[model samples]
Target: MSIWISWMVAAGVVVILELFTGTFYLLMIAIGLVAGGLVALMGSGHELPYIVAGIVGVAATLALHRSKYGWKKNSDASQDPNVNMDIGQSITVKEWQDNGNGKFSARAMYRGALWDVELVAPAAAAGVFTIVEVQGSRLMVRA
Candidate 1:
């Protein structure tokens, strides 16, 4: 088989694999292979060596991935309401409990189940407490 036909077949296979991986890296390599095939077709004596094409494909893929989806150290805080929805929900304290480690108690009717609660202030009375923050399933409260 001709070099051009072989390169084209290889490029087509890489592109098909790219569809499964979805990482864009494989697609880049496929593009490089297509370019090599084109060079072979054009009879450009300056054919891209397979190793050089592979390296170029990888570098291009990485650069594109970084520029398009890289993490930013200074990204703006998320504005989604789901993250801040628990700020002011009223919760009922289930027991009269206290400790020297600030204030703590168990609460019922919170986010579905009884929860161990802690607060920055003492809630001596067992009743409803406002949820100020949530740490996992535990609620931080204030009376």
Candidate 2:
């Protein structure tokens, strides 16, 4: 019925939505709605509450934008498989095979599975290759 009650309800709804979104934007706006409610409680005009709410919301959102948690994560981290724990493990190349891509490949037993190993350069007979990077189940290595 009262303006303060309406602002409080809006803030409560935003807070509920923030739980599912996992973002700080909604929570910042909720802070603004709470500010509006407080202004309304102080017997201010209808316009003043709205203005206060807008200003508070903008300020809060900007604060969040500048914070570390607000920005998007680096996509490179997800694309590079070398970030994994088993990246630097070594594998033995019993023999080298032609990959048809102008690079040589081989089958190596790694992590309990026969993995496709990509050798950047020619490997020696019965050479051991240290895993430099992983691409899916395959490994990129140097002799």
Among the numbered candidates, top lDDT falls to: 2
Clashing pairs in 1: none
Candidate 1, residue 45: how far the Cα is off, in Å: 2.8
> Cα miss at 119, model 2 (Å)?
6.3
How good is model 2 by TM-score?
Answer: 0.65
TM-score of each: 0.51, 0.65
> What is the Å distance of residue 118 in model 1 from its true position?
4.3
Q: Alpha-carbon error at 135 in model 2, in Å?
A: 2.0
Instruction: Provide the clashing-pair count of each candidate structure.
Output: 0, 0
